[model samples]
Target chain A: MLKNFADKPLVIGVTALNAIDSPGPGVAVIRALRDGFGDNIRVIGLSYESLEPGVYLHDLVDKTYQIPYPSAGAHALVDRLQYIHGIEHLDVIIPNFDAELYNFIKVSAQLRIMGIHTFLPTHEQLDARDKMNLSKFGEKYKLHVPEAITIYKADELRKAADELDYPLVVKGKYYEAFVCQTLEQAHKAFYQLSAKWGTPIIVQKFMKGTEINIAALGDGEGDCISIIPMRKLYITDKGKAWAGITIEDADLLDLARQFTKATNWRGGFELEIMRDADGKLFIMEVNPRFPAWIYLTAGAGQNQPEALVKLAMGEKVEAFSEYQVGKMFIRYAWDHITDVSEFQQLSAFGEL
Target chain B: MKLKKNIATSENGFIFNPSTGDSFSSNGIAAEILGLMKLGRSADDIKQHILNTYDVEPSQLDRDWEDWSMQLKDANLTEL
Candidate 1:
């Protein structure tokens, strides 16, 4: 009971192949694609660096191509992707990096001319969840979010210091966050993060509680296609969930659906949640794209990425009724032993 | 430098320190160098061996050797 965008087999491309301590969602996304399509789909691995391990996972990925980094801007990315599309004739391109989503959404119209289908949120939906605008979003939706103040200049942190107590979180625009006990530590994290990820760094009240993550997919019409809530069981020093377990929480699912209803969210998203001692849940962050732990969705019951592909193809899909409870996912690293010849081939030619 | 005791290295490039219960994955070159270190090879010997087997210059390999040593130390996978 599946339909394809075309008569011929479909070729789909995904980006952000980095799967290290700070894992990217590409590998997990690809795995979900395989689970959904089996041998019917051809997977194209789109990556920024030559050393992204996913490119060399020949079994999981059919072919690999290196694309320009997001820092090169959307036009360069569009040009590079067009070149790759000429050879690959990709039908769907699922960009898996948060930093690159704006570029992909910007070119979604242009990409459609080449028959490349992308199902993503509008720029407004993406901005509604931005860290800088999160407070406004909460006020509009009546959702609970942590108290956060964005400071453009590091010195501006002092202006907001009196309002927030010590041991707040200093977060960059795109990535990286540090907890500062003293104002000096806050200043240090502010400068260090701003220099790397640019301005409007966020200083948030550090909430102490259990961290929960919910990865869900929306049908673009305010209907949630799937929802799975997982609590972090173990975390690496980098703050990535090393291991997690699915839990049965009706409140979390209700909140996730309410979020989708409020925004009419389209495509995949992950919500970073903090549950206080009083059983109050505060939305800490809203990642516009799928989290690195997305494979758990497929593992639990719903293949959100697969469902996303179908929706992108303009196909109707039923909402996932349920998922397994108490299911666990433990991430482990493995050495992918491949010759330097393959690396040389891709680095020099931009294709493999 | 020598690899820590109870260290296990897999051909898949997985390194596990049984004592610490920590696991790590490495690239091909790093894994090869680690295998050499596990056999009690000197830094110079390992560098020469890598230079012969891989397409890296001696100067660059020397720098990478130092970096890998630091990584090993940081991971607590080696004894000096």
Candidate 2:
């Protein structure tokens, strides 16, 4: 169906080269895209474990394939890509892993040479995914950013902490962060995360406020069509939005517009913002891909995954005019069989 | 196992508690529970209705409804 944009059927190679069972954000996006585009686009799910099949693939994607991940370098992944290309004519590649994204960006041109389009940002553009780099970008763009510093070693963290206020946040360079209530907690978090990730981390002054998220899709140039601002009313243990509302905040939307234009960002992006007690908005972090709640926004009205896929295919996309402003969604997972357990673990629904 | 009082929920799902100044949003099921609470229905009564209408088993509904109702109370979204 997407052959008009390319030379063949819209076959998107999806690399979930990480653990595939859990309902992560990338997997959620893959599901949404499949649902929206249907058989018009073929999906090739590449993962590590042979049995680590993705959830919702049966109902969503065209075909599901599992590929073993290379422990060392890019050889296994590239081989798997060649195998996928052999099966179906490839049109686009969606890398669902950060590590895979790093590899995919390098070979984006090669994939294009084979008539495949990928929505990956450039190497310099990938810095937007890093929290520390995002903070600096926020500062550079004159966006309100919290007092923050990135440190490589634990010794440097201590010195930076001494200069900053207490009750700070120690965050991974890429994906997660934790708020440390005390210096002892911060020190512990720094060691644990640094040990696991093996990189410099961000320590920022913890700002108290209502957390708001602006999720949108840019055309990879400057124009953005949809603006979905959600207020995080309830939070989970992992800082995911348990329940959120689609709020019509012009100020927040304007900030997103300004920020995207400043960054020249393209693709699906979710930016976390903090509305402090003083009514000041501060940019928190930028996720290069869709959020776990991407489907919620799609459900609410603005289908970002479909728009993103269309944009990647070089189609003239429609601009989002309005959205269902107050809808909500909840994550659902299966659990062990029990009398009362079924209801407890049944699909959770939340206010959007 | 009963829902408390004073959860002022609107038709549009806007929930406001004057005592705590806290607000929340409820889905269709939650709105139904709130309406039942307003009518002075017991937890057992609501559970019976839920199981009768929905495909859910009784005990499972009982636990989640109980916990969620308690959370409403804790959040000061309930009158009690």
Candidate 3:
């Protein structure tokens, strides 16, 4: 019978790119795993690129290694596994970024075959990551999501403008947002965005009010162990929260629960939401991986990253978290600059 | 500036003002500071008291107090 990992098992966190970026979910997961689990966990942070200056890999992990981006997909990842296994037998692999999550899912079955446990869900979890898919799921779950219409060609956006309200949002099928002030602006935005980002451009009704995020980790058994709901007090150029505060919104928590339950989701996830003028909440997007602001919640008593690592090790953890309200999270400029462009680009192609 | 007399706070972290009905919650420190504000203390007085009582630095206390006071003002928590 499969058993929970023995104590102090080797845990490796795999990332596809830069490691120095702060205010990222990966950084929080690393810290929480080390802080919460302590000597019981041996962390190894692996990336596809060199370590950023001023970052001490040894400080965060027992070891650090780099692997080439999986150009050949499965084969490249398998080679990385071989390399990792050679150094120290890894018991679990945690994919931190969206790109790495995609790669991890592609090779998930193979990893399980090798006695390596990965908390990654199947392709069904991919639906939650795609903005369009989550919007559809929202309807079935009775949760309100942004009114968005997807179009293929730039001219098709004219129909979106005619059908939707003014000040519509012009976004790619995956990620990337541009505001359209008029129908003509929508068309221009569609073309420019499509030319730069390719396919399924979406126009969503603009929601004016507070932006909020709900993050959680689940056991794949209809039980969520941790939930952190935050309201965006300050948003950056990339729409990342530069400053945010923990909030107690029971309705928002219910929405998150309904959405996750509808998907039968397991593992760590984040939901981007906004409250309209009437106080009605609508989901903006769903991220399958942890958000860059996970640590803000960590300090507030919901250590989701730690929960994920623990769950992956087959440990029995609490089924729910009672989060503290009134805590604040502030993201520095450097953290915002480090990965915004690249992450946005990858999001455009649905590659992340 | 005159201080507003209406003050509201709940043990569960809920705060609502009968004057504006604007609601909010605060962390331990923010809650403490706002609680003091309910006693009708001036901003400078509150700052001085917090600095003297807490191990926090003067600048940090001033900045946090200023931000908190501004938020209260935005919510119309201050006097007319």
On TM-score, the leading prediction is 1
**TM agreement with the true structure for every prediction:** 0.80, 0.74, 0.74
Task: State, as a TM-score between 0 and 1, how close model 2 is to the true structure.
Answer: 0.74
User: Can you tell me which runs of candidate 3 are displaced by over 4 Å?
Assistant: A1-9, A16-24, A51-57, A68-71, A183-197, A333-352, B1-80
Query: Tens digit of lDDT per residue, candidate 3, span A85-186?
Result: 666677778776654566778887787777677887668667554766656777677778888887887767777888887999998754468787988888
DockQ of each: 0.01, 0.03, 0.06
**Which digits, one per residue and each the tens of the lDDT, describe model 1 over residues A1-352?**
3344356667999987899889999999999899888887889999888999999998889999888888899899889889989988898999888889999999999998878899998899999999999988999999999889999987788877778887799999998899888889989999899999999899998999888899999888899999989888898877789998887778899999999999999999999999887778899999988899999999998889999998888888999998877667999999989999999999999888
- Candidate 1 differs from the real structure by a C-alpha RMSD in angstroms, to one decimal, of 16.2
Clashing pairs in 2: A220-A266, A244-A352, A245-A352, A327-A352, A328-A351, A328-A352, B5-B79, B6-B79
Each model's fnat? 0.00, 0.00, 0.00
Candidate 2's residue-wise lDDT over B6-56, tens digit each?
446776666765322256887888888777777888777878888888899
Q: lDDT score of model 1?
A: 0.88
lDDT of each: 0.88, 0.69, 0.69
Residue A128 error for model 1, in Å? Answer: 0.8
What TM-score does chain B alone reach in each candidate, compared with the true chain B?
A: 0.90, 0.80, 0.73
The CAPRI class of candidate 1 is incorrect
Winner on lDDT between 1 and 3 is 1
Residue-by-residue lDDT tens digits, candidate 2, A1-352: 3457334447776655232233346566776776787666666655544333352344444555555443445666566677778877777776655555667777677777777777656777677646777667876888888888899877777777777777788987665688987778888888888887767899988899878888887776776767788887777777878677677666888887887787677777788989886678998887776666777777778888778777777788877888876666655554423343322222221000
Model 1 reaches what TM-score against the true structure?
0.80
